[model samples]
Target: MPSPDPKIISGNANQPLAQAISRRMSMHRGVKVGLVDARVEVFNDQEIFVEVFENVRGEDMFIVQSTSNPANDNLMELLIISDALRRSSASRITAVIPYFGYARQDRRTKARTPISAKLVANLIANSGIERVLTMDLHAAQIQGFFDIPVDNLYASPIFALDLMHHFQGQMDDVMIVSPDVGGVARARELAQRIKAPLSIVDKRREKAGEVAEMTVIGDVTGKKCIIVDDICDTAGTLCKAAEVLIDAGASEVHAYITHGVLSGPAVDRITKSKLKSLVITDTIEPTQAVKDCANIRIVPTAPMFTQAILNIWNGTSVSSLFDTQTLEPIYEPLYPGLAIDA
Candidate 1:
């Protein structure tokens, strides 16, 4: 017997992203990959309930949910939804979590600290999720926490494309700056992609979410600096790093962050900061305050996620999405014989 068609579903966390992905899938496949109808609700007392309205028996399933802001609530919803799908006899379930929450707590910094990332991984796997897909984890090592397959996608291709477009003729004047030493690898990758110089922001963090005594580790003088990072929560570190880069003689500072957590006062800080612009992806849903920020821009990840999902479903190479020579998206549909309408 032939395998059943793939089914895409979403929890309440990021309905817009899920919808975008579904639209792209339908467009690319030349067939409707419509989102499966489901109802996810929370009780007044804070309990979560999930009900699937369509039959998913023996069908491949993908759940799009970002464990963002209300991390616990969203996480619970994902787990509950997964449970519902599994109980309904779905052949395989993939968790397409654009932003995996508690990822920063992958290891123990203090004596009593728990590895919450590992715990979350266990919760996801135990909930019968057969696979996981996420992007730009705070720490890549968190991939090892999952016993099942985890595809950790990169956002560098997206950022590199945007940078090249914005700096079309001025590529020589650009530099990629990692907000801190730890992210140098990520920054270096982007720099290599755009053929730009690499810089680092060396800083000491006296506490979480705060930076102190930052210094530039490379010559950013007279360069248009692009700070690359995974998450931008609170925006304290980002705003402070932009200030430090400006003081160090950068011509202008911009940021390309993957997950925009934008927690308390992040929008305000980005608005008042020295950065010329902040480019972030729609991995996490943007609030109204973020939408109104004049200097902040949001790029859609639906197309990238759509391609990755198709490649995974078809057992093709997802890494080939980026061309090594040009460092741009290849733009070929993963599904064979499906012409993209111009």
Candidate 2:
């Protein structure tokens, strides 16, 4: 006999992504998801009002919402939805956030600064979320912030497949470039899979979202560079790195970032930069400005997340889902002894 289907529900954060996930789940036997009419309004005083329209009694409910634009409002909606599921006698609740906000504030850089990522984690746990499913968090350590089980998925496998399919013969001339030292692990993973040389752009930021200077840390000269990173909010560092790479004799430059949080003048900057293309995942909804940018291209992650959710539901291992070219792990055991097949 097959296992019972988990009830997947969604809020107003990113309905399209939720629906895509639902459609993928429905393709399998005995699996289905319903959307709760979680509409919200702001009072004249700017207070949030949320309503959950579906019954979740005794069901394994999964609430899908990405705290993207208007982060506070979306976050409140997720909390309210989770609370409703809990009150309705739902067996379990999983918060599926494609793009988790406040992740950039994981640690305190200066004194007295709040660790907002931990605060957000606490909020989700207090809101009755039993587990969390998100992608490419800005800081991997933010997973420790949450008390509940958290599954941090990677976009490298998806990106690697796309690169191989499109640029198979060009791998020899291609170089995987990390925009900074912090992203070396992510870039190295992609580099090993594609069998390309690895490079790094040593960037100095005088202030937030501002790149003061850049130094190429590897032999990028005469190479077609692909800069990889987790997030691209303002695109300042990426643009500066592309310029520096070109100045260092790079033949071409491209970027493949996981989350495209193209805020402020990011689209304008990327459109004018030396980057040949800027590929990103659909973790966050893209704006008209981002869609209109000629250099931007989106590679869908629906298939990848779809497989992961199915594996989790069917008691299968998810490690093989990410194992490309048999490379070693870069993360330091976020959940030790917790087998994916369990």
Candidate 3:
């Protein structure tokens, strides 16, 4: 028998995305899935407050919170809400974090440094969330940090479909480029999906928040170059990479990023850069600046969330929603014990 329909609870980080996902869930199941009302606030003294208004006892709960900008407050909101659901006796609680914050800090590069991503994972797990459903984790290995099931969904499938529809005849003229060596696999998968040639950007980061140089590994001359990456913060590396591509005689440069962490001059940089357009998913709430940037476009991720949540609720396979070669779900467990059938 199918499990009970899950209740959709949202956070303040990305209300638009939450509403879209909630609406789509009802549209798909042909039933209005009850949404539990949640209130999150901060006191003037800097304490966080979260409350779930509706009764969730004995219910399957799904909390939608993107730990995006204002990362601390939003992260607290998600953790506190999960703790509340656990205290309230919710049968199963799954955290739906569209864009996980602190994910980039997954490893330790120097001595006396902390693996902050693992700490965040431990915090989430200790808060009592049985499962996590997130999109395009910054580091795939971070899933091993948690003891729960994580669904790490990819944006490549949707991106490929959109690229095919928009650039049907000119697909041959386009070359998919990874912004760095770390993203080669991601870009290669997308390139294969769209039937385009692959290129890699060899970039060296001098220090935190600074990229020294970037060199293209493959030929981009006379081609329409499309740079792809998981996150775009400050737009520094990406814009510079586009300039390099243009200097290499590429016809045009475009970017398709999964998360748009457009912080600190990102909009200004993008507006003045050589990029023809920047396509990002609606995982992070777009500020007025992002919306006003004529060259930037946003794609909806609600449908993907809807399908994955539905499959989880129905106890069906979600493998088809992940990358074709990887066969990994949105929430992939890093540890062997985290392999939960749910």
lDDT of 3 by residue, 1-342 (tens): 223577888878999998888887887678887567878878999788888888888888889999998999899989888888899888888999999999988998889999999999999999999999999999999999999998899998767655655566798899999999889999999998777999988988888878888888989999989999999999999999999999988999999999999999999999999999999999999999999999998878887888888788777777768643332232222111222222
**Candidate 3 at 237: error in angstroms?**
0.5
Model 2 spans with C-alpha error above 4 angstroms: 1-3, 30-34, 41-44, 325-342
Estimate, for each residue in 65-85, the C-alpha lDDT of model 2 and write its tens digit.
Answer: 899988998899899888878
* TM-score, model 1 to reference: 0.93
TM-scores of all predicted structures: 0.93, 0.90, 0.92
The true-versus-predicted C-alpha distance at residue 199 of model 2, in Å, is 0.5
TM-score, ranked from best to worst: 1, 3, 2
Residue pairs clashing, model 3: 143-334, 144-334, 150-331, 151-330, 151-331, 152-329, 152-330, 152-331, 153-330
Better model by lDDT: candidate 2 vs candidate 3: 3
Error of 3 at 98 (Å): 0.7
The total number of steric clashes, by the backbone 3 Å criterion, in model 1 comes to 0
Superposing all C-alpha atoms, what RMSD in Å does each candidate have to the true structure?
A: 4.0, 6.2, 6.6
Best model number under TM-score: 1
> In candidate 1, where is summed lDDT lowest over 10 consecutive residues?
333-342
Ten-residue region with minimum lDDT total, candidate 3: 333-342
